[model samples]
Every structure is written in structure tokens, then in C-alpha cells.
Target: MAAPSSPPARPVRSRTSGPWAKLSTVALWMPFPALLWVGGYAGAEPRLFGLPFFYWYQFLWIFLSSGLTWCAYLHTTPTRPVRTGAHRPADPGEGLR
Candidate 1:
């Protein structure tokens, strides 16, 4: 009986400094409190859908950030190739099943 050949040895990958730093900074700082201040200030005195401007303005962002975070998470998520190529599958039966 023939034995299966050894698989390719994967090399360790250290995190790159530039893109990760830029991404982390942008990700962490993008949705900060000053943003709320800017948003509230911009939307002040603007009534919408029968809701007062000030009250609605702050709440608008609650929904907005939820969606934004979902999108950001999606953006950060790995695609088929990137994930599959990165490391071995978590479960042994992943490939066959």
C-alpha cells in the first residue's frame, strides 16, 4: 500500500507593521465620541419623521454604527482563499465532508 506524501511545511507569518497599524488605528478611532458630537451638532434642530431633531439625531447613530460595525466586520472577515490558504483547517474532517 502507498502512503500519502507529507504535506508542504507552512512558514510562520509575523504581523506586518504598516497595514495593521493603519487598520487598527482607523478601526479603533473612527467611531469615537467626538464623532457623536460632530453628528449631533450637524443634525441639531433638524426634525425627521415627526421626531425632534436632537433626540432623533443621537439615536440615528445607534442604528448607523450597528450597521457600520456589521459592514466593518464583514470587511475584516476572511474570504474563501485567504482563510483556506492561511492555515490548516480547524477540523480534520473539513475537507472530506
Candidate 2:
């Protein structure tokens, strides 16, 4: 039996580079610390729809955190290289000929 061929190695990409990357990293990480420091949102004033400030604030963070996470995703996602005609394979009929 023939040995299995190894897969081609992909280039190593740095996800933490660039300004957007920094913003993404912050977006992905800041919520935890911000939420953990409960003193910032511990008050009951400035109610929303009869909800206490503390309760509504935490709820608001849930959506804000999700939006930040999406921003981070957009910023950190790796873009694929566009393929040009040069990289395409010849037609099967041409190959057969």
C-alpha cells in the first residue's frame, strides 16, 4: 500500500495585526471585564420601560456585546485571495485532446 500524502501547509496568518484587529480584539474581550466590574452599572435609577437601570443595562450589554462580537468577526475574518483565469485548469476536453 502507498503511504498517504501529506496535505499542503497553509501560510500562517496573524489575526492580531492592524488597527481593525486591535478593535476586534477589544470588541471580543472588553465585555467580560466591563461586565465584571459591576459597580459601573449597579444603580437602579434611569429605568427603561419600568425595568431597573441595573437590569436594563445588563440587557443592553447583551445586544451591544453581540454587535461588538460581530464587528470583531468582520475585522478578524481572513479574506480569500481572488482566483484569476491563470489559475484555472484547462478544460477536460482539451486535456483529453
Candidate 3:
């Protein structure tokens, strides 16, 4: 008879410790409130490069959101240690093995 399999292992959780991680998480949520506040920037009085305030305000946020996302990625990602002592193999194929 076939042996029974053991239960699957739990997923390894990444360490998200530190104030930077917390701050990054908060930064990720900033775009939500900024975009949701339609009443604040809904007016057409303030024109940006001939575009109405409502259109330009949302368009400007596209770049702002991208920047915020990049910041969060930098803060939350685990950095790898630089391999200073390691040398590349003379034959690139040897390293693959």
C-alpha cells in the first residue's frame, strides 16, 4: 500500500519589521484618499496647461501613485547581501551545474 503523505508546510512569512515598513504601508494607502476626495479637486477654475482642474488633478496623481509605489517597494523588499568574495566561473556553463 502507498504511504500516506504528511500535511503541507506552512508558508514562510517575510519579516516586515521596522518603522520604515509601517511607513511604506501608509504611503501605499495615500493614493486612495487623494483620489476619493473628488469634491476637493472637482472645480474647473484652476487649469493646468489648458486642462481642467478635475482632469489634471487625477492625471497628476498617476505619476504620484507610481512614485509612492516605488517608495513602498524599496522599503518593504528584503535587500540581498552583496557577493564580494564570490568569483564567476571561467566557463559560464560550469556555474549552471
Candidate 4:
């Protein structure tokens, strides 16, 4: 059997953790206006291959935003399941396997 892991990884943060994380997160959203303006103009330029530019632009984001938000959300989340057989520590006193 494999050796048990050390304690669950503890996230460490300094005093600036809050402001830094929040600032960067909020900053990521700050680019929407420019994307909209440019996307709008580009999308407004009639259809491409029979799809309207506006429609295409918005449609593009349907895929883009889902991916972006998913990426961002995952980024903020903690480590996920590992493919190996290892597992997280359970309730105290649970005997080691």
C-alpha cells in the first residue's frame, strides 16, 4: 500500500491575500466593456458565411464565457479528485487502512 499523505494541504495567505485576490478577480471582469465595444463593431459588420456578425459575436461568447467562467471558477476552487487511489483524511480516529 502507498504511504499515507501528510495533512490536507492548507492554503496559506498573507494580509494582502484578500485585496490581491479580490483585486485581480475584479480586474478580470474589467475587460468586458472593451470586448463588447469591439465585438459589437466587428459583429455589426454584416453576416459572415450567412451568419450575422452581431449574432456570431454573441454566439461566440456563449462558448467563450462558459469556458472562461468555468476556468475562473475552477481556478479559485481547491484541488480536485486525483486519479490515484489516495483519498483525503477522514474523521479523526478512523484507523489507517
Q: Judged by TM-score, which candidate is best?
A: 3
Q: Global lDDT of each model?
A: 0.59, 0.77, 0.80, 0.60
Q: Which candidate achieves the best lDDT against the true structure?
A: 3
Order the candidates by TM-score, highest first.
Answer: 3, 2, 4, 1
How do the residues 1-97 of candidate 4 rate in per-residue lDDT, one tens digit apiece? 5756655544543433465457547655744863668644564567778987867776776677667666656556545533454555565555553
Alpha carbon RMSD to native, model 4: 7.6
Per-model TM against the reference = 0.44, 0.64, 0.75, 0.46
TM-score of 1: 0.44
Candidate 3 C-alpha error for residue 61, in Å? 0.6
Q: Write the per-residue lDDT of candidate 3 for residues 1-97, one digit (tens) a residue.
A: 3434555554544537788789998999999999999999889978878999999999999999999999988778776544344544668897477
Question: Candidate 2: deviation at residue 65, Å?
Answer: 0.8
For every model shown, the clashing-pair count is: 0, 0, 0, 0
**Pairs clashing within candidate 2:** none
Off by over 4 Å in 2: 1-16, 83-97
lDDT at 18, model 3: 86
Q: Which tens-of-lDDT digit does each residue in 1-97 have in candidate 2?
A: 3434545555645565789898888788988987898998899899899998999988988999999998888778776544333333356575455
- Candidate 2 is scored at a TM of 0.64
